[model samples]
Target: MFTVTPEAQKEVSVFFEGKEVQPIRIFIHGGGCGGPMVAMALDEEKDNDVRFDIGGIPYVVEKDLFEAGKPFEVAFNGMGFAVNSSLQLEAGGGGCSGCSSSGSCGC
Candidate 1:
């Protein structure tokens, strides 16, 4: 059940506007060194793909990926869109460790 938040639905419409509309394809992206990641792209339907509709938006995912990534959700982060999965992908920490101006870390 890949779901799209309301704000994401709007963004989706805007993103594909004036372009050829295709079902949003969701799949797990193996980052290897970085970690397992989920990604989305516009893709043509495949023979083994499963289709689902969320908020009137259609999406397709490979059967196995769908089983693994059920209950997925798409949301708009401040900078861009992000795919949130039940599988947690932890971030590599340690940011803003460098010296800062004034008394605050810019980050």
Candidate 2:
């Protein structure tokens, strides 16, 4: 299932306040020091996508990814949207062995 909070809906609404709106695509973003994260971006629908419409906004996630990350939710945190899901990633898949907290690893 896919869900989006009212606050998150408003946040996206405000972003498109004066422009044409596009569907928000949820997908695997990157595998950095923190690991691969689910992220959102403006995109069009695709043949393999699963779509959800919430609060007048459309969200789409690839079919396989939607199944892997079942029961996804989007909520507005203080600063921005936070995506929660049941998807699991392998530990240390991105390998941060020598990375430091001083932004040296570009985390």
Candidate 3:
């Protein structure tokens, strides 16, 4: 199941106020040092996707992905949209020698 908090709903509504509304696609976004993260995109629905409606907004996710990340929630984290799910992602490897930052390296 998918849910959108009122705060997030309001933000989304404002974002689409003067534009054509499209279904929000929730999918797995490959992460950097943090590991895989959930993300949102505006896209057309596919045959293999599962759809959910929250506060008049349409959300779509791949069937297999949705099944694996069941019970997802979309909320506003003040800075941006935060998608929460039960799916646990394993962290990526430690920083490489070429990485510039000592903390959270991209390489």
Task: Report the number of the highest-TM-score candidate.
Answer: 3
Per residue, candidate 1 scores C-alpha lDDT tens digits across 60-98 of 888887777677888987577888877666533332333
Sorted by TM-score, highest first, which candidate order results? 3, 2, 1
Candidate 2 ranges beyond 4 A from true positions: 91-99, 103-106
TM-score of each: 0.72, 0.85, 0.87
Return whichever of 1 and 3 wins on TM-score.
Answer: 3
Error of 1 at 46 (Å): 1.0
Which ten contiguous residues of candidate 2 have the minimum total lDDT? 90-99
The 10 consecutive residues of candidate 1 with the worst lDDT sum are 92-101
The whole-model lDDT of each prediction reads 0.74, 0.85, 0.86
TM-score between model 1 and native: 0.72
lDDT of 3 at 94: 47
How much lDDT does candidate 3 score?
A: 0.86
Deviation in Å, model 1, residue 65 alpha carbon: 1.2
